[model samples]
Target: MVLGGDFNTSRPELLAPIAQIARECDGRSYAPGDASQEVTHYTYVTAPGPAYGTYTSSKLDYLYSTDDFTGCDSWTQKADQADYRATTVPTGVSDHAPLYGYTCGGPRLSWDMHGSVDGVVADCSAYDNNGSTLGAVEWSAADGGAAVFGGTGHLATPTPPVDSRLSLSVTAWVKIAANAPTGAIAALDGSRISGFILWYEADGATWRFGMPVADADGWNVDRVIPTVPAVAGKWTHLVATYDAVSGQMALYADGALLGTAQHTSVWKAAGAFTVGRDLVNGRPNAFFHGSIRDVRLYDYPLAPAQAADPTL
Candidate 1:
């Protein structure tokens, strides 16, 4: 159901065979940031020995799938990642960057966090629901100007991002304070409780993504705490996903699935969406103490491949 390789040509005429197959067999091409054409750049240089020779600048690699998929990601960022990086051709790992997508639904919201922090933080997604800063959150130069949370600062949207009753996925680039003990990364607030909370637990020094079964709950939380311990002073790409249909949740760190657990007890937490902070028992708690950037929210759960991107 999947086809992939370097065709050595970017011309439309030469790729007609794959296009014809797509039309005849209900398949479609999957380019990293586009849906209509193959667009992985040809970064190969015909020279050697630290030569900045003329580099090819056209699409030369491609992938097509007969199975339905949602969001696409390019291997163009880090040594590893839980989500796609903003740039292409990550640290010259290869002459041509890899292109791949996941079997999930379309994205609903995102914040690149590369905008001004003095004014309203713009939402990069199509929703147009801008964000505002809470407390004394300042901007850091990391990841093209990320929001730095100092125990009690964060970014908040006017309304909730998604209905927690449905399947959902969230990604964020986080680097905890070297001296800080623990903190929360992201959440959707509610009057009585937050929908879900992805935070750092100091007990095991692990990343815990927790979801309560009901709105008015006890201590019943299906928490997916990965076995890997978090490292401070460096950015960690974290992704947490919940598939409502399967009643399962997964957590990924640095482009790898760490763990999964059953968590079907879902409730819609209706309130403003907040980053770098979490709301527990209808109150403010677990203020993140670090820098957060490139926060994204998807309305659908991401598959294992869409998350374990090797390019970071």
Candidate 2:
């Protein structure tokens, strides 16, 4: 669930209700970085507009959610950093800069290493989200980071049987090791066919997001995002979505739109979903040799605005 608006979050009387609902629902605020009671809003400057005469800074807007579906841990306040804007002066967008968040964990699958023990990939979703270890994997690391394909590492689960007629969106945060250039982060494949895949290209610098429906001559649609200097050894968030109605596919990095294309074929792979690897030629190859975290899948295209936010 999500709740937001100009709640005058700075006021103790108003913050009371916000805190009450969030605590009761395990929710968190999107702005101000954390669940702390402190509020940060209202831009103050000696200019003309809303804050020209007030000469006070106050936080009047807020957003809260019960689900960690957006994959965003903290909100970056533009007002906090003086150098946030290099040369261009702040435009009068409003008294507030845009509050950003990413579109994450839909009604489908969601997983992370948050609550894992020794070497388990705990499914935090409310329904059939547990994954069976395929080959071997290691989880002895920091929070939300797990190593895959040491020798052979992967995770698999029975297909959730979501209706193919619906749209699709998949997102994952991964860090690829130098040794392992090309690897797959996730794929949905059947006995001999595949539905969709989120993997790194052979170049190891670009990520390939593809959906190959059974009826398509080739991949119904594919998007390659160039991420070289910014990808290696760094945790990069990748998001790909397909709009069934519009037949459009879009790919994003971090929270920025990279590119988009069109796809018209329907999905038909009623098989298993695999993470940390992809099935090639009926075999699990393209094994990911890095840390994977915050895997999410949605059954619908994310709103364009939400996709732009790093913490939705």
Candidate 3:
């Protein structure tokens, strides 16, 4: 269900097999970033026998998955602690340490704007320099009769009373208009206001999620669920959920699981929340350029069926 490698090239040839497996299993590939960004760099370091000469480095690890199996819940590249003078290691076997397991879990799902909106509050009475606006809109008649977000706009609201529970899922039925600028994100932030944030971005067509890293200062973390360009002007389902016990975060596109991350108790009770843009800076820089509907948030992480099930 899971495959990883260090493909030296950035073309499909290196990733085609992984993609095939995902397609056959009804799953998808989850890379940290797209090929265009060239996040996958190849390098290695050779220290001069404690003499401390120039060290070599390379990017050689990648994670892939089949459609039947949900992708990894979390992943990380290893670095030398001693090289950075952060810690001491007994053996200097290799410049790069082997990849290690950090966290694990299946994909999670929840509704963002489903059912009653009693406890939810929307703050859209403002506009930014990019002509982006935020406000709550009712779902259109064509969209399964759910009162979802309307217009090519973005908005942020506080987690309603119904979402006070610890572990929960969030789902949104979204449509990105044709030729919309990339770098758009739809996210949910923890109560810390600065600690942990879970978000998805349509980076020029590739979909990615931003997650937290352990023991790292600031919000240093990884991005998962890398893929080809997302079709413009089409309805797609995006879901993210966290299991407090397992400390896993999963991302689902449409009805298929894409990627997962591992973490423990990432979400705290901070009472801070946002959508459409990165809220850490308190601005709408990466604004979403599409229509969102059926935004639902739940108190518990939804099962795969609950997330992809149309009946819900």
Candidate 4:
């Protein structure tokens, strides 16, 4: 979606050039219409100590949406990443307020793994969200060709194309090599905080759809785990979904509904949706030790019935 803002005016209508830019780009933003007010803003925080002080400001934030954005969800303020924006908004509370737009419609990012040893994976979607392999990650002939990660490698996408705070679904054909303890199957998270993660727990041998309900940290994660065991060396269709309006998440393994869980608040972990690994608090945590194929990412939550068969 097109994001435009941080201009020298209060009225969006008055901003002719910005509006034109949005029109030309064919995207939307998280701009509000209350008029003459910009409540959620990005900030530049200062050192927090005896001489700590946060009393400066810069331009306003740009959080608008595209014309085609279906049911544009709310634009949330960005939070401080490792206290980077420096911290604290003008209100003197909270860390950061990022503007996120949920472009709910159809598939936004897709990867059809078709080759072995591919360095640059193509994004089959209309948007150019191509991913690249990092470290020891490689495209293997397993599962009709897929990316295999060996603990210390992963596939990284550019700036996230879909918003993490909105209704969304992620699906893939996964093959577990062996159970270690835990590893991120796939996820969307911040630089040091996670937003949502589709992971596995060897202790329970279950596939879980997790979200940090209480906070953006890793420990506060709430999950909806499937009873099905992630049989090692076998391919299983895995699906994880989140309903933004309801604050709920669901998981499915091989077309069967695992279960559901509730997360009443918008747990913010705005960052690139990744493959083969999920990160939090600047920790490696765990990388997916398996092969992931036919990864499809949709902007809206998929119903239980539809989860059985996702269109590539």
Candidate 5:
């Protein structure tokens, strides 16, 4: 299998999952061979500031694979500018360079199947989507499921591509097989307009929504949304929202409002977005080990009724 994109962090903690998957599939790895060869560093950097310069450059993109197949021989990073100096692109485009590669999988196959979406039958199945491997995450829909990560894992400072502005509502249907660790943040971080993040502390089962504060060393906290009394095996819907203007944050569970907080400003828009961990201290830590599905992000805050509707 061939995979490429901004893997975002080089920390061992966040790379563990990708490591495990590589071990299982016998995949070797290669990063930009040198700084001069680095195609794109720092996926998230907002314009118009000096500290902005502090958060400069690193080879955040990568490509990896299991035992090299016959047709899949090499990969390359395609830079938009030949000299590697950053420049503008078309609308709705990210500054990060794109990754191109060749893979040796057999001739493609096709078929049709139906499944329930809002209780209505739809045509789709596992084979519809191809798969790839990231640092530690091996994703494949054809392996009898949509996407599977190798064991519970962590990530550090994983940011989205530069020029990618994500304004959306996120809904996750999660089944927690193992209790998460304290300070587990499942939201966006490390960006100028930091995205939303949801975290829970195992010690108290107290949940909080973390958003950016206008000045440094400040974080606005919403009221804590307590988790349901722990049950060994159970599924839950954990939702959060951020109104760009109000800098207001809210949390909900199974349709009930849990807590809210107010900030002077919303998250800065340029930086890497991360899932299952935080991008702090120049790396990712506080990983979450659980089953997460139907992870959706919306540009606007979702209404209580809309968030609660079971059919969604």
Candidate 6:
């Protein structure tokens, strides 16, 4: 998607340039009308200063998206109160009004483990236009009580999201209190374990996303991302996706693509799907020493923009 705050799409000269870009990218404007009543850009015709006077409202700002954006369900432009120059007191907050687009059809499992003071189980608010219980996970509080897990504080769902027939994507928000030598973020382990983990080398200065692949040698295939700077004490959003159709695996950190590799293995998780630790041979290992929240899983690979947009 491409967005402009002060694009001035009302004029042919300015709109021509944006139109060229939209054509090259195969995108369309959010509002496809040519009327000043659809105006987002407001101005004053009788203001005190020359710079602020002799101007009429016009639709200037725009949002354009590609053809693959199939879930654009609605668009709303703020038309009242602070959105316009007339309704605001002492003018307005900005020359342009706010615009919003709503979408649907994402996330097979969403665990917004919030609103809990302290608990041993994290509830899964699991829904995907269709609803079912992914089940609550068992998690013990870590020592010092900041949600750190040192091989002890782990969680598991009775039903796993892994299936050999579907593509997969996982996303999480994590805050690392102190860097671990190595850690597990989430895993689906049974007789043969396969999942996303992180290895922090260089004495906690760097970290990498590790995906253990199931192979003939029994989980010997390891795909590792290049080490990145470990920013401790800050929240970072991580996204990892595996496309069964494309045979591609990608890892992202803080909305930026880190690396990609081919992964053709079919995932059939039976033992348990877990978080905060990895289960190898049906035991917890590589426990994460951090706080995890907003962990989501999907049956389809997410677009890079969707994965990166935290609001979605």
Candidate whose TM-score is highest: 1
- Candidate 4 colliding pairs, count: 22
C-alpha lDDT (0 to 100) for residue 205 of candidate 6: 59
lDDT of 1 by residue, 160-266 (tens): 87888777888888888876666889888877667888898877788889887766634567889788988888888888988776678899998888899988666
Would you give me the overall lDDT of model 3? Answer: 0.47
Give the per-residue Cα lDDT of candidate 4 at 266.
61
Rank order by TM-score, top first? 1, 4, 2, 6, 3, 5
The 0-to-1 C-alpha lDDT of every candidate, in the order given, reads: 0.72, 0.61, 0.47, 0.67, 0.44, 0.54
lDDT of 5 by residue, 127-150 (tens): 222111223433334413222233
**Deviation from native of the Cα of residue 125 in model 5, angstroms:** 17
- Give per-residue CA lDDT, model 3, range 1-312, as digits (tens): 665555554455556756766531112222322121223332323454664533444445455544232222222134332444433562344434343221223222223333234434332222110111355444455655433433344545444322222455656666775666653445544432223333434455655555554323355654455554567777777776666555567777776877787654343334334445544443434555656555555445667877686433
- Tell me the TM-score of model 5: 0.46
lDDT for model 2 comes to: 0.61
Query: Which run of 10 residues does model 2 get worst, by summed lDDT?
Result: 24-33
Candidate that scores best on lDDT:
1
Error of 3 at 151 (Å): 10
Per-prediction TM-score to the true structure, in the order listed? 0.66, 0.60, 0.47, 0.65, 0.46, 0.55
lDDT of 6 by residue, 1-312 (tens): 544355656664556665565421113222222122245666656555654434466666555533232212111243322322444353444556764333324565666644233443444545422122222323324321223445456666666665533466777776665645466766665554545444334353554554555512244544645557768767777787766656677777778887777755554555556667665654566677767667777665677887788743
Q: Tens digits of per-residue lDDT for model 2 on 1-312? A: 676665655554556765565531213332222453333455445576764434356556555665433323223354442322253454344455344444445447778645344445566666666777767776645754555556377887766534444477777877777756677888887555457778876564677777664533433344545554346677788888777656677878788777777666665677677787766566676778887777877766776665665432
Model 4, 262-308: lDDT tens per residue? Answer: 86556456577788788777665678888888888887777787789
- Better model by lDDT, 4 or 6? 4
lDDT of 6 at 177: 52
Between prediction 1 and prediction 2, which has the larger lDDT? 1
- Clashes per candidate (backbone, < 3 Å): 2, 10, 36, 22, 20, 0
